[model samples]
Target chain A: MITFDDVVKVYPGGSTAVDHLSLELPTGKTTVFVGPSGCGKTTSLRMINRMINPTSGRILIDGQDVAGQDDALLRRKIGYVIQHAGLFPHRTVLDNVATVPMLLGKSRKEARTAALGLLERVGLSAEFASRYPAQLSGGQQQRVGVARALAADPPVMLMDEPFSAVDPVVREGLHREFLRLQKDLGKTIAMVTHDIDEAIKLGDVVVILRQGGKLAQIGTPQELLDHPADEFVAEFVGRDRGLRSLSFDTAAGLPVRPLTADLLLDEAGRPVSWGDGEPTGGTFTVEDSLRLVTDLAITSPVGIAVRVDANGKADGLVPHHDLVDHLAERRAAK
Target chain B: MNLSYLFDAAHWSLTADGSIPQLILSHVWYVVLALIIGTIIALPVGLYIGHTGRGSFLAINAGNAGRSLPTLGLLMLMVTLLGLGLTPVLIALTVLVIPPILTSAYAGMRTLDHRVVDAARGMGMRPWQVLFKVELPMALPVMMSGFRSAALQVVATATVAAAVGLNGLGRLLIDGLAVNDYSRVLAGAIVVAVLAVVLDLILALAQRWIVSPGLR
Candidate 1:
């Protein structure tokens, strides 16, 4: 757990990077700090590890004053990932990941073993252990960077726009990987990014900052989408955010389709023949949201419809009741 | 000019055909000894300059000054101080190796990536650990180049010992010059060049081993 009590940062040139920012980052959850450039999201995240010291007030990690501790020691207990990965070009991937562990007095063999395992956990093959950072692609390098951050298994992770340097496709890929890692590790993660959709997809809680490093808002994705604190946040999360609220809830139920031999063959399961009775017409063709379902119950149709695959077996069969209930639930969540 | 003369010279130095073989043996030994001693003196000084980033002005100026010092002037001065012997020649040769080495080592260290060093510090490394583990590995290739050039300079300069009547291949050249025998001068010069090239090749291989590819 980390708490910031009116922490402020004033640069030597009299620029205020963070202005009396106070927020609590719950432990075992992912909180993303996001805003435009110079908004101080990165600065705030760095303060948790004492990389950037606070000018006033206090930053407490698990209630201990982080400023009083040795900076190196404080950093060792807090995982940090930066853009470009900031990996030591001189060290191999394994040694790069093991840097903190080796410094903390772990034996070389022990550190290497831990690093190799973390690399594998982050989706890298053990063969990349001996290779250098230059050997990995952008996405692979990001994974190795993540692996290095988790090498010590710190209770909290601090990321400063780590995925922003990669291309959109790779950025999205890294976002999914980060989500999986966060789910599995359950570390108190504080990531700073500039992309709004990324904040929504990866953040368990999103923190939005305004131009002057002022706290604009902080809330769960659904809450922020449903109830933005101010116009700036609403605009930043974008007008489409309300539509995004649909995926927030846990999926209610799966539609039931007819049990047919051909569909079952494609599904690679046991086949059951369709009788005179329909499976309540809850199946819709894979292609009929805006076009022909060949048989689908949609906006204009009130009755249930059964859609079949090329093999004449049920693929997606939608019922009017299921469709109406699902839409209503989605709209209400929004 | 013939195999007999070579065999005769060899036997003379070791098995008593003449003192010529002994003269040649002593000369080779002198060159090798001076190189080892100079390397010991220079490597530490070079590494220190690279690490400390201080006194570089004096050190670099001193190296250029040493290189500019005429071997005859250096030898003549040393002869006055230490007397006409192997010690003066060795001192002069050692001073000759310093400039190339110190400059290159310092340049290499200064050029290493600050980001890598910052990352090292961020990972909890002490200042000394950062220099040795990070800076040194990055500096090795360039540092080795310095040593190679210095060693070559030493090999070429070692011949100056003959000007003071020391025994070396320089003695053969001196003897040949007195008798107007150009072949002996050519032969001695060829041998020195080949020796320098071979030593450079060895150091180049060592450079490969020292510079980890990833850092490059």
Candidate 2:
């Protein structure tokens, strides 16, 4: 777990980038800090590893104060990736990814082996390892950047708008990949983004910071969407946040039920198929949260959406009423 | 100095005990020797000033002063202080070449992306590792160009050493001027210009060869 206790950052010129802010991040989940540009979201992320020192207050990583640790040693234990991928242009992709491992005293052969494996994990082929950063496309470069950050397998990763540089399509693809990786890897992550859509899509915990780096609100996507705490968060989340609340709920409550139930049973007594097409995304299995069901419905305007089986077969359906109430109940609870 | 008159100049030197080969060899050796020594001595100075981003306090003032010094003027004065011969010529040429190299190296290092530096640092690079592995690699292309300019200038300035009694292509012009041999003057000027061109081309090739292939 990473905790920031009354942390603040004041630039040399006396401008406050982060006010006296405090936050806690649990292990094995993603916490996203998001705000407009210069709102100190990035500054907050940088402080976990002491990339930017807090002017006051203590920052603890797993309850250890960073001020008392050797900075390089501290940073070596926390992964970081930046907006442009920050791959060293002169080094080959493999060498770039192997940086921290090599620093941690791994043999070159061992580090290279680990790096190649990570490259594949992040979706780059081993053949691309010898190539330089300039040779990679923007999206591929960012993947290499992620691979490099994970090279040390640090328990926590701090990223500053890692996907913002890519085109919208690539950004979406990366977001999907990141979610998949997070599910599989379970590393605690703190990511900063300016795009509210991204915040809602990926944030297990969303921190909305006000203009001067002060915290406006912090909650799960459902909680923030349902009760914004004030006009600033409500406006920042935009007019459509009511709809945004539903998806988070779907992931939790509405797992696909037995098709034999009163909801939308078909000839085989299954949720009716739109062929093999899924209605609520494939996430609504007996395993998935109702929040997943809600997101699938939002993806399509039709009143009913199907949930898919592991083989992509339609297993069950979720209706608009069920999705809508999930969000409403969450808001009322807040 | 007439082009038509230089044929007579070569004949004139060739007939004077065939001294042309010996003279050219000696001149080449002196200029190349100074260039190598000057580069070695100046590299650390240049890299330090450039890498630290504090060159303005010293590099700008010193380099401007160095650039403005009349090299021949300095050679004549050094002839008295260091006492004429290769010593004065080497001093003058080395002084002439260092400033361009130092200032350019400083500027190149200073202008590099700070994010790149931070990334290297954040990756657990030692300060030395960052310098050798990252900062130096990026700064090399520009620094080499500076060295190129310095070398070309050194070649041009080396010809002026005849004032200090060093036997170089300038010997031809100075002797020709002393004896009113216009043919000799024309030959010396042609040789110096060609030598400068050749050295400049070599420096260009060195740059092409030394810069990383990606940057090239």
Q: Among these predicted structures, which one has the highest lDDT?
A: 2
Q: Interface RMSD value for candidate 1, one decimal?
A: 1.9
True contacts kept of each: 0.58, 0.36
Please state the i-RMS of candidate 2.
1.5
Question: Tens-digit lDDT track for model 1 on B96-152?
Answer: 877777777777777777656655665656778887878788787777777788878
A114-151 per-residue lDDT for model 2 (tens digits):
99999999999999999988898999999998999999
Instruction: Give the lDDT of residue B55 in candidate 2.
Output: 52
In candidate 1, stretches whose alpha carbon ends up further than 4 angstroms from where it belongs are A250-334, B1-96, B161-175, B213-216
Which CAPRI category fits model 1? acceptable
RMSD of 2: 4.6
The Cα error of candidate 1 at residue A6, in Å, is 2.8
Model number with the top TM-score = 2
Report DockQ per prediction, comma-separated: 0.42, 0.49
